[model samples]
Target: NKGIGGFMMIKNFKASEKIGDIVARFPKAAEVFKIYNIDFCCGGDRPLSQAIEEQKLNQKEILERLEEQYGTLRSMELEDVDFRKLSMTELIDHILNTHHVFVKTELPRISDLITKILRVHSVEHGQTLSQVHKLFGSLRMEMEQHLIKEEEILFPKIKEYEQNPSDQLLAEIISVMEETENEHDGAGDLIKSLRTVTNDFNAPSNSCASFVLTYKRLEEFESDLFQHIHLENNILFPRIKA
Candidate 1:
C-alpha cells in the first residue's frame, strides 16, 4: 500500500500533459522545470514525455520532483496570481501593465549596461561581449515591436471581440496570435543565444562592479521574460483559442 501510494503521488504529473499546461496550472513548477533545463515557454507546446526523453532526463525523478514541488508550493501563498482565473481583459491588462512595462523599462537599462561593459571589458572579453550586445540589440527590437503590436493591434481586437464575440473577430484574433507566437519564438531564440554567449550570465572572477551587474541584470531579464512569455503562450493564447 505504501509503495503504491508513493507511485501514485509521482504519477500525478502525467507524462502526456503539455509542459506549458503544467506550468500554467502549477506556476511554481516553472522554477523546478528551469532547474532541470526544461522549456516551459516558447518550446512548451509539446508533451512532458518528449522533453524528458530529448533532454535524457530520468522520467521518474523529474515527475517526483515536480510532484513534490507542486505539493509543497500549492499549500503556500505564492506571489504569482492564479492567471487561469483572470478574465481575458484582466489577463491582457496584467500582461500589458506587468510584462510589457518591464520590457520597456529594462531594455534600455540593460542596453546601456551592456554597452558600458563592452566598452570597458572589450579588450579582455571582446568576443563574448560583442555577441551579447548584438543579441540584446536584436531582442530589444523584437520586444519593442512585439509590445506595440499587442498593445495597438491584437489587444484591442481581443477586447473588442470580448465585448462583441464574433466569429470574424475570433479569426482575426487567432491570426494575430499566431504571428505574435512566432515573434515570441524569434525573441526566445535570441535570448537563448545571449545565454550561450554569456555562458549562462556567468561573469569572470576579475570582473568589476558594472561587469558583474550587467550579468546579473541579464539573468534577471531572462527570468522575467520567461514568465512573461509563459503567461502569453500558455495562459492567454490557449484561453483565446479555446
Candidate 2:
C-alpha cells in the first residue's frame, strides 16, 4: 500500500468529483477510493475536488485522472493538513453509521428476497438464483460472524489500545484484523457475483416489486460493503499499525 503521501490525486474534477454520491459516476476511481477506505458509492456526496482537499493531498502533484476519455482533466488541492494524523475513532464512526447500518438493515431483507425469488424463479432461472442464494447465505452468515468479531473481540481491543498502547493487545487485534480482511475479500467477491447473477439487478420485464427491491437492495448493500472494508482495511488498520 502507498504511504498516505503516495496516494493518487484526483483527476478531472468532474469525473472524480462524485466522491460521495453515486458509485456509477466514478467507477474507475472507485478502486482508488477503495484503496483509501474512502466511500465514493453510498456516501459519495462530496465532490472529488473537495475530497482531495479534505485529505490534505498535494493538489499540484496529482497526475491527470486516468480515463478512456482522453484529455479531459483537472487539478485540485486543499489547505495543508495530513490525513495520516486523523483519529481512527472518527473513521470508525463513519463505518458504523454507513456500512454497519447497511448490513444490519439490508442483509436480512436480501436474504428474504433471495429465498422468495428462489421459490418463484428457480424453475426457469434456477442456476443463477441458486448461486445467488448460496452467496446471499454465505455473505449473511459470514458478515454476522465478522460483525461479532469486530464488536466483541476487535473494537474493544482497539479501544483498549487507544487508552493504553500495549504491544500485546495490538498484536492480537492485528491477528484478528488479518482474518477479518480475508472475509472482506470473500464478501466483496460474492457481491460482484450477485450483481452478475441478477443481471446488474435489472429485473425482468414482468418482475414484481419484491424482485426489483431485491436487486436494488443488493446493489446498495454491495456499495455499503466497499465503503466498510475500505475504512477498516485502508484507514483503521493503518492508524492502529502506526
Candidate 3:
C-alpha cells in the first residue's frame, strides 16, 4: 500500500469508492479520468463503478490505468506537501492566494482578447464567437460574485469556526457552502457551454494570431478553473463537513 504521512493510498482502486474522494487523495488520477471523459468536478459525487457503467466504459481498464498511473507518478507528485494534511485555514489561504488571484488576473485579459477576435473575425466566425462572448460574460459575472462570497462571507466564517467552533457557525458554514456549490454548478455549466461553442477551444486554420491566442487563453482558464473547483468541492468542503 502507498503511504504518505500515514495516509494510505487506495491499493485496489475499488469501484465502491467515490470519484471525488479518489481525486482528492490522488490528484494525478484526474488526468486519467479526463482521458476517460470522466466528470470529476460537478459529477464527482458518484461512485467509480456507477460512473463507468453509466458512461459505458470498461471498469477494469480504468481501474488498472488509475493504479498504474498512481504507482508511476506517486513519488513525483505525492512527495510535495499533501493538500489533505493541511489545516483548514491553510487550505483556505492557499485557495485564496492561488486560484482567486489567477481568476482575477485572467478574466479581464481573456475578455478583451475574446472581444478583439470577435471584432476582427466576426464575418466568418460570427455565430460561434458571439456565443463564446455571451457565455464568457455570464461566466465572468458568476465567478466575480462567487469569489466575493468565498472571500467575504464563507471563508471568514470558516476561519471563525476554526477559532471557536459552534453548532451555529457550522450550520452557517454549511448553508454558505451549499449556496456556493450551486454557484459552482452554474459556473461549470457555463464553462461547458463555452467549450461546446468554441469547439473545445480549437481555433480555425486561417485564424489570426489574436484569435488563436484567445482560444489558448480560454483553454488555460478552463484548466485552472477545474483545479480550483476540484480543490473546493472535493477536498476543502469534505474536510469541513467531516
For all candidates in order, the CA lDDT equals 0.80, 0.65, 0.81
lDDT of 2: 0.65
Report the lDDT tens digits of candidate 2 across residue range 1-242: 31112222213334354565324322344555665556665667776666667777643433233232212211111224333465665455445433564476567767998899889987787888888899899989989888878867887788778878888888998999889989999988888888888889787788778777777777767765875787688878888777
What TM-score do all the candidates reach, one by one? Answer: 0.68, 0.63, 0.67
lDDT of 2 at 113: 86
lDDT of 1 by residue, 11-99 (tens): 34678889997775455568878999999999799999999999999988888887776444322223556879888887886676445
Q: Report the Cα RMSD per candidate.
A: 16.4, 13.1, 16.6
List where candidate 2 sits over 4 angstroms from the true fold. 1-86
Deviating ranges (above 4 Å) for candidate 1: 1-80
Candidate 3 deviant stretches above 4 angstroms:
1-79
- In candidate 3, which residue pairs clash? none
Candidate with the larger lDDT of 1 and 2: 1
> Which is the leading candidate under lDDT?
3
